[model samples]
Target chain A: MTDALKPGATIGILGGGQLGRMLSVAASRLGFKTHIFDPGANPPAGQVADQVTTAGYEDSAALLAFANAVDVVTYEFENIPTAALDIIESHGPIRPSREALRISQDRLTEKTFLQSLDLHIAPFADITDAASLEAALAEIGTPAILKTRRFGYDGKGQARIMSPDQADEALNAMAGAPSVLEGFVNFSHEVSVIAARGITGEVACYDPGENVHRDGILHTTTVPARLSASQRMDAVLLAAKVLNALDYVGVLGVELFVTPQGLVVNEIAPRVHNSGHWTQNGCAVDQFEQHIRAVAGWPLGDGQRHSDVVMENLIGDDMDRLPELAKERDCALHLYGKAEAKPGRKMAHVNRITRPQK
Target chain B: MTDALKPGATIGILGGGQLGRMLSVAASRLGFKTHIFDPGANPPAGQVADQVTTAGYEDSAALLAFANAVDVVTYEFENIPTAALDIIESHGPIRPSREALRISQDRLTEKTFLQSLDLHIAPFADITDAASLEAALAEIGTPAILKTRRFGYDGKGQARIMSPDQADEALNAMAGAPSVLEGFVNFSHEVSVIAARGITGEVACYDPGENVHRDGILHTTTVPARLSASQRMDAVLLAAKVLNALDYVGVLGVELFVTPQGLVVNEIAPRVHNSGHWTQNGCAVDQFEQHIRAVAGWPLGDGQRHSDVVMENLIGDDMDRLPELAKERDCALHLYGKAEAKPGRKMAHVNRITRPQK
Candidate 1:
């Protein structure tokens, strides 16, 4: 096994969005330089990262250079091409491992992996073709969601079906890509556990946060989630189980649905989750730092929340509220340096301290 | 007055030390890009800043180009050359104003300015020559400090005159430079208030943090300092007084001595100060962001302490403790991306939460 990375080591991060941007900032705080690799130009991460390679993941030459320049590799997104991972892994260790990525990249694989651990999850069926899609629909019944098995995020590559009559239209929307149909969860509320595991197999979890979504986009995450003590314990334990099962060496974001029966796993992000953004103001060591510490093989930090925080995302035109939000007492405004405020884009966020209430 | 800067505006920062590094990170969080200018190559600020101009402040062309590229200019140090400021000011506004820099750069001018405002300060006199030094020493008495009026910081360019017999040697230590002889204040302890003034003239101050110096270097700053409620109010009000006196448009660090006679102003920094580092873990909005917000003409944030914190600087060999310190609970580590841990150099710091104990 490789030795723990010392300060001044370069951390190569794949995908250069807000998560990558935040991770870059956290790495710098720990005295580690970050090199960002993304196909997009002027990525948010590039604004703060030490280096930026604006080349597609398919560019093996660029990927090789990135991996070789940094002591270790980590990613902000899970949908990186397996081919790119293969080239990068040959040069350095990739935190969370290739196995975690392989499973998380496909809905079918992710669900099956969770089931293998005997964890509770929504009932799902893999949709390879129209015949199978219809057959799976018959078993799953109505009010289910059709999702692309791969490359689906933020409600993209998804369609909702309320009745059997809509199955063909939903299937057509998939455009012949592999898909998964999940029975709609009867959840009272959604919560996420931001958990991390160090390279030495040590795990830590932040308090679960209750999340609210608008138009399939995360709107806000409030700490002190509406969960009983036992429920909170269950969430953290299950999250730890997943990390250990995957032998993950970085942060994993586990989303769950609170139901009458029990908490059901909805999805998992193999990186810092949006729901945990509240930790930036509420905890001593935030999720980004925890991820950096774990990836660098350093000891995990205290994940305890010091105050009640409500993290609200500034989406697109939500940036309009910034002038007023900037004046709000006990509010910590964190804006991603995105040039344009496009619709549904996460432009910024405000972590408002609700405890020691004013 | 210039209108408030919108998100995505570039902020030009002079100096690229740890303070600049932190300012860059804070500016990025507010969706403002920072361009760091420093004579040193590969400065700590460059690790996270959007851009770095590794050119001397004497390079007027480079300074002008830098100033014209950003919406506003601020600094991490007060010792910037006046000629450079003249060139930069022609292109963009400099927050905290040039007057603040001019006054704070010179000890005599700073003390005189404070005295004019009816603020209590140590008795001081200007010494342009040995004869004047002797005269000032006689008036200020023994046990006074001889300091260079300009370009002195962190115990540099200072000599103590403990007795009349040592006057000649102390004067020689000045090396023919302009100097100031100030009678030291007999105080209980030193504390600093990190205060900010927005362009619109609004003011906000973080709670005073008790300071301790080791060999004239800052050792620790603990917030919720050992002060009565009245002393805290006095500190905040005096800090605000300094900001308003200068019509300051950014964060200022005000060092004060709590004496039996009341609070006596020691020094005022026109930018974020080391004593204010505790705010990073103690308050919702840190000094860096407060400085950024003020410079950007945004509204000030709540500076109230949510958690008590003790910030300790990890100077040089202190880095050896990072391994164990990283494992400490409720500790937030901030390391500057400095390549070498040279003796007396600040490599990193740890803000440990001490309140709501353990």
Candidate 2:
């Protein structure tokens, strides 16, 4: 096992979004300085990070400098190019590992990996061409989603196949990119487990949080998700199994579909997830800090939920409600410091604590 | 009253110490950016702030540039020179106001201000010279403390007068600086209330926290301090009175002595105090965020303590315990990203929750 980092170590973060911003804040709380490396100028994370390098992923010189300046490297998002990882890993260690990223980046690979572990997942088939798409639809049937194998987020790069007649249109929507046809699960509700694994192989999982989505975007996540005691234990155990199988060393968000049969594994994010944002107000140690601790090789903190919280994302024009939200009692606001409030863009979020029955 | 600031506004912070570092983090959470101005290079606040100006307060050009870059100006320390404020105020509004600083910066003025509010305060006399010192000693009697009128912190520039024979020695310790001779209060313990005043004149106060001192430095602050219901109300009321009197526009830390008669005001800090560190873990909105909200003209948040917390400061060599502390459950650590852990320096702190009887 790698030795834990001492205080005052510099942590290199490869992303400059809200996740990176919150992670930098958490790293600072642990006496670790963060250097944010992103191509975007004045990114949200750069506003709070100790240092910022506005350079592209292919900039080998910049990447080398960033790697040499920090004790460890971690990414806020999972879509980092393999070329970038090849350069970053040469100078320092990267937590959560490249293998986790490789599998999660491709929907086909992720499904195959989960199925290999005997984990219950939705019926899926790879579609690399028109012939393959038709064959997959014949097997998966109607009511399936055709999603691109990589670089898909927030409902983008996806099309629903409602009937066999629409297969041609759905295939056309793939735009020649490799895709995966996933049979829909009749889930009563969706839930996510934010789990962490330390370098020493210890694992911890937060209680599952029920999630509600609108327009394929997350709207709200409520902690203490409605789950049977046994189901809760099952969700945690499944998440631990994934983390251990990958030899992960950071926080991972495992999305699941809760059906009458049991919990079906949907996908896994190799970094802190939006559904886990409620932990910032509901637990003693939040997911951002938990991720930082794990990546720094420190012991994972307690993930027990101390308060019931409902976290709502402020997307698109939600910036107009800031005046009222700022005045709400028991509400904690977390703004991403984005310059513009573009449509579907996540500008901020608020976590309202409803528990302890205060 | 000034209009409330919207998100995305820039706040200029003076003195880039740990308090400023925390305040910067809070500002970022509210979708606001912070610019830290300090003479020291690579200050703790600079690690989290969006901008850093390494210039002395007396550097007029740099001070004006900083003020112009931000929507408003606030400070983490009370010892800013009057001349610097003159230049800064010309560019942007300064929160807590210059009046609040003038009163809190000097021990003599702080005592007089509390007395003016009809609040209980220890008897004090101004000491400008040897004759004044001797006369003040006669009036206050032995067992008094001779402290510098300004720029004193952490028990520095303070001399104990245990007997009449030590008067000359104590007076010599002042070294020609203006001083205050305060008669000792026979109090059971010390407590502090972290209070906030919004731009609209709204006031809020956190529950008092009892403090313990070791070597004239704060060791720990425990929330839900031992107090009767009435005494707690009194503490809150006294803190509000101080804030309202000054028309303060940020968080203030009011130290009090719980004497047999009633609560005696010891002094006031214009910004968040070390004693209020427990709020970061015990309250939904911490003192740092509370200060940010007030200065931003947002509504005051609920200051009610939700959990019982013991905030212990990691001073100097106490850094050695961080490894063990990191493994302790229910502990939230806040470290100041300082490079050195010099003697008597506050390197970090931990708030251990003893709440919900877990």
Candidate 3:
């Protein structure tokens, strides 16, 4: 099969959440089977995957067995334990590579990498303790966010420092873990570019999507983001630079703050992003399939959008509106088969095709 | 759960071929799990389904277990054994009902049913024996088709008679099985209406797609088929009439011959058809998802096409061209993870978006 996996090759996915579920579906579309490895029983992706390994990442034996069972391993999320990744890597390749994971897994490492690339990023300082926190606060300013340097997502393990007086409380939120204090970027809006790099060093980027967040979770993403022609070009160029620098394969999500000065790199995820969900309906080749193609060594697909779409995440009680959403015209519902829709949990999403833009 | 199966409910599907595979994926998008029951081991749909029951229809025990496990049962093919259906129905409800299956399972019955609805159909007569075949030949005339009343598809189980002298050969091709002799329609082209009827009896139809066949197998289907506005209306209305007549639930494919006089009903499928594959790329809610929604008792999604698409089947050695197709711009490839691609076996399909039509 060479580097490009033939149809029927099994892809091992690390997380069995909505992203993995959709990835499994996309892999199936390309004639590839998927095996999901997640700790949770009957995870969302497990419902569609050909096989499931219901073992935690800490289980070395299970991890080894999982890696041995599939052609290659990929993940829907970062933050994988280093030992687990070592075992999998020893057995088979991991798409997006371990360097991309190591960099994005830590805030300090991520911001440093982006800064080294000469990309615009928010002012940031590393904080180790109360002394360092005070010093960093003095340098970065008071109106900033104090975030744990690792394992923070969806506003978790972070606290906002609205004023100098709130420094102590904000620092306490880090709970003695290594943290980074980031000065807030005064931007008009947030936008994201979902990009992919193939094994052969080719890069493709979807158009930037204007994102709106509520409670630090993605609420909606509308394509044809309010970007100037140059900013759109800059976004794709920056994404390509990052992909080349990392020698990355598979999809990456770049979140940027659109400021008057330029686009600021807010963060980067080494896998499929929530904001890219619009591509499921707006493009012939979506992000999930593109990621699979890249990882499997297939040629990169065209990522141009054909429809203008507004993708709204269905959170918690949003399931209550499903009756109406299902009947809405030109609205496509993608529901994660979660047994319970906990508050703030993404239960589903709906992509409303506004019109054919291309 | 009422008539409408909730998210996480299981949908039991018969015939785990490509249609079932796509249906399972669509069911997952709607937050439903699928259980595929097929006699073949490791069927394509099983690769993506939540569960699989690999037992033949004759196995009453497996049938009972399968029916009991699912909230509702639907099928990819209509030729389900009656005894198997009886067992499933005894345990739970089957969408599209037994009536639709009964009517479409045999050519004679299907033609008779279509004629009863006052729809235009090619002259057809039942042939139970050589005497009956001779009588039907006298009525229907030469340049006819002698087809088995049961188990015929993709030009199989039928023989073409270009002259009266070929009648005996054509009749012999039936091998003493009940048959139907039908006079060929002088049509410009063939088109199909992929329509769905919800549990509440609301009907929705996708724009008719023009079909081209090779070796009696569907070669391609292009949306926005060459039909006048009135012809389009007639096609949709005829499909709606069939759905209403059968009190059908789930998607149905109605093939029509576009004759100079009017649209002639060639045949109808009780489930999703190959000619409707274009909807996957052309419509917001495709035929597979529409079928899942109907069987699950959800509202019928809007079936309007948003993009101009041409879907071509990858048959047998056509799989060799996958590398080129994968690199083709605006093309979406859907491969069935079949182990072997024998001659005439549908290996996959590629939908090429020509342009945004709507």
Question: Whose TM-score is greatest here?
Answer: 3
* Steric clash count of candidate 1: 0
Those runs of model 2 whose alpha carbons end farther than 4 Å from true positions after fitting are B356-358
Give the poorly placed runs of model 3, Cα more than 4 Å off: none
Tens digits of lDDT, candidate 3, A1-358:
2579999899999999999999999999999999999999989999999999999999999999999999999999999999999999999999989999999999999999999999999999998888887888788886899999999998899999988788889888788889999998999999999999999999999999999999989999999899999999999999999999999999999999999999999999999999999999999899999999999999988798889999999999989998889889999999999999899999999999988967
* Model 3 docking grade: medium
TM-score between candidate 1 chain A and the true chain A: 0.98
Give fnat for candidates 1, 2 and onward, in order.
Answer: 0.84, 0.76, 0.87
**Positional deviation of residue B254's Cα in model 2 after best superposition, in angstroms:** 0.3
Model 2 chain B weakest 10-residue run by lDDT: B349-358
* Ranking of candidates on DockQ, top first: 3, 1, 2
* RMSD versus native structure for model 3: 1.0
lDDT of 2 by residue, B1-358 (tens): 1488877899999989999999999999999999999999999999999999999988999998998999999999999999999999998799989999999898988888889999999889988887887888788888999999988999999999998778889889988789999999999999999999998888989989999999999999998898889899999999989999998999999999998898999889999999999988877799999999999888888796767889999999999988889888889999999999999999999998877421
Residue pair clashes in candidate 3 = none
Model 2 TM-score is: 0.98
CAPRI band of model 2? medium
Top DockQ hit? 3
Q: Encode model 2's per-residue lDDT on A139-255: one tens digit a residue.
A: 888899999999999899999999988888988898989999999999999999999999989999998999999999999999889999999999999999999999999999999
